[model samples]
Target chain A: MLADQVEKKAPVRRRKEARPQELTTAALSLFVEKGFAATRLDEVAARAGVSKGTLYLYFDSKEALFLAVIREGIVPIIEEGRKLLVAHADDPVRMLREYLFGWWALFGDTELGGVPKLMTSEAQNFPEVAQYYVREVILPGKALMREVLDRGVAKGVFRQTDSELVTHILMAPLLHLALWRHSFAVCCQVPDMDPNAYLESFFDLVLKGLAATPEGGK
Target chain B: MLADQVEKKAPVRRRKEARPQELTTAALSLFVEKGFAATRLDEVAARAGVSKGTLYLYFDSKEALFLAVIREGIVPIIEEGRKLLVAHADDPVRMLREYLFGWWALFGDTELGGVPKLMTSEAQNFPEVAQYYVREVILPGKALMREVLDRGVAKGVFRQTDSELVTHILMAPLLHLALWRHSFAVCCQVPDMDPNAYLESFFDLVLKGLAATPEGGK
Candidate 1:
């Protein structure tokens, strides 16, 4: 009788375990498409092939759902970046390159690309959400980048400069590229800008720019 | 009687001449504060110290008013850039530096700083506006930067890189700074970031990066 009961509940438990990821994935696409205020909970449920009741069980509110999406989808990518920083400890130059390219491959090139545009569009209206993103996503990401730059400088591969400022510079183009894709690229005739080529040029320009050499060496 | 009539008409003419500008300033602030779709016309008129009737006389619609704002407030700045390019014809480096700084001073540092945020937020909702901006502002700006890069390469002051890609790279940071100010800075405790210092670092980085020398000169 005990074995029979355990086997009967196993399938239900397995399906329940997968619900949050499915729900957050559904929420991300909707948030990207319709923005935060306009997207309805029912639509998210319908998109995820679940009922409104099921969504409510997983996330009490839209804000909670958004936070889960960030935690589940975005934080993992940032964690991977931290791991890469460790893995490439001795080779700061290669580490920086890999980290940037890895960001492009994992985040910028994915559906997650829409997050930057979403945050830019709605951050003012939702202060708590903005605060959460800054605290969780942006600050941590910047810290990771700062570590890379610091390592480079210490290794004598990069010039001594304000790592904080350089981190901002490194991120600006990538964020702008993502913002352009979701905003103007959606509505305007933004001539085909290949993302890979853009990243290549960015990497080439910035790496050469940051190299340690005599001032006015050229 | 003629002198009296001329005096009476002069003040009216002067105020009328300034109405469009006043109205646009009001509209720009409101649009930046509340995204485009939410801003109402009467509030704009009220903010400008004019009646809705006066607003109608100047602009037939909200869209027309936004275009006028871009035309009256922004176009002149880009035009000034063109003149600078010509004025510093023999000095590509100074021209590039001046152009970037002038952009920060004339546009990014002013009320116009909000325009980039406005466009980023509402461009998908207003395709015509985005098209007009692309045609009138972005393309021309990119053309100007490309010319500077080309001139630099010709003068052997800058490296041989794709000017098109470089122009995009050149613009991303400045645009990102403006976006940060209008979006995240409003709500978050973004430690005091000096705009002038940021631009100086950017100029230093890129100019050195673009210097034509043997690869890996460092």
Candidate 2:
């Protein structure tokens, strides 16, 4: 009986550890599909194939679950970015390009794409979550971009400019592209506005703008 | 008695003509403050100093009032941009700068700033209204920018590129700035981010990128 109980407990412990992430993944889809205010915890549990009681064991409330979703979605990306930054520290231009595209491949191209739209949409209604996100996710994200820009400027590969403002400028189009895909693209279809093409064009223009000298032997 | 009654009737006709604009202005504030789904028609009427019945006289439903707000907010800006475009047709670079900064002065600096945030937040939930907005506002707006870019490219003042994609790239940062002001700026105070300075920097980098040759004899 003891041996059988130990065997059962091993799987239960593993399942318990995994429950929070599974719940957040399910919650993210629902939150994105049906704005945050409208998504119920019961539905999240149902979508995750867990009971409401199981969800409560992990998250105390709907807001808690929403925060978890955001944190879970972003924290991993930030960690991956840090690793990429270290790997490509020697080449700031390449580092910058890789970082921008890497973000799209990991976050913008995935269901996590909806997080920005979701946060922007519901942030006003949920100030605490907004503040927390800005402090935790946004500031760190900006810091990472700023570091890359600073490195480029230091290397004299990029022009000397305000890294803070430039970071926002660099990010705005990409963020807008993601938000547009999830929001207005439903109504206003510009057939030529492919994400890959847009980002490529954006990077081309931005890199040229930042270069200390004009390309093409100018 | 007949002369007095006629005088009163003249004022009533003028007031009736102004009522729709006044009602939409009030509704715009409420919608921006409280959001679309949460805003009550009766409250909108109260804010406008009119009764619910009077609001219904101009707008059949809350959704109608919301559409009216969008239309009223954007239509004037579009008309003004058209006039600017015609006035500055000779200098595409100056025209682009004027148009970009003019947008910030007129729309981004006003209560109308909230419209982008409001629309982006609610567009998915209100597809018909979004469709109408795209038809009435967005496409025409993009056309104005495209004309500026085309003129620049044709004059060899700017590099040849996909104007459609470039138009969006140009507009995204501007739009994002406005949306950010209304959304995350409430909590995530990036103290260094002065809007005018940000736009100035954006225009500088973008204009530099588009120039047929690098500026400053570099």
Give the top-scoring candidate (lDDT): 1
Q: In model 1, where do residues sit more than 4 Å from their true spots?
A: A1-23, A38-42, A49-68, A214-218, B1-19, B50-65, B214-218
- Report lDDT (Cα) of residue B141, candidate 2: 79
Worst 10 residues of 2 chain B by lDDT: B5-14
lDDT of 2 by residue, A1-218 (tens): 36654554434334887899999999998888667866788899989877899999999888899899988887778788778777999999888888788888887988998888888877787788888888887788888899898898888888888888988998898898888887778656646478888888888888878877635321
* Candidate 1 structure, TM-score to reference: 0.85
Among residues 3 or more apart in sequence or in different chains, the pairs in candidate 1 whose N, CA or C atoms overlap within 3 Å are: none
User: Interface RMSD value for candidate 1, one decimal?
Assistant: 1.4
Report the lDDT of model 1 for residue B137: 89
Q: Candidate 2: which stretches are off by over 4 Å?
A: A1-16, A50-57, A214-218, B1-17, B214-218
Q: Determine the TM-score of chain B of model 2.
A: 0.87
Model 1 has how many clashing residue pairs?
0
Give lDDT per model, in order.
0.84, 0.82
Worst 10 residues of 2 chain A by lDDT: A5-14
TM-score of candidate 2 chain A against the true chain A: 0.86
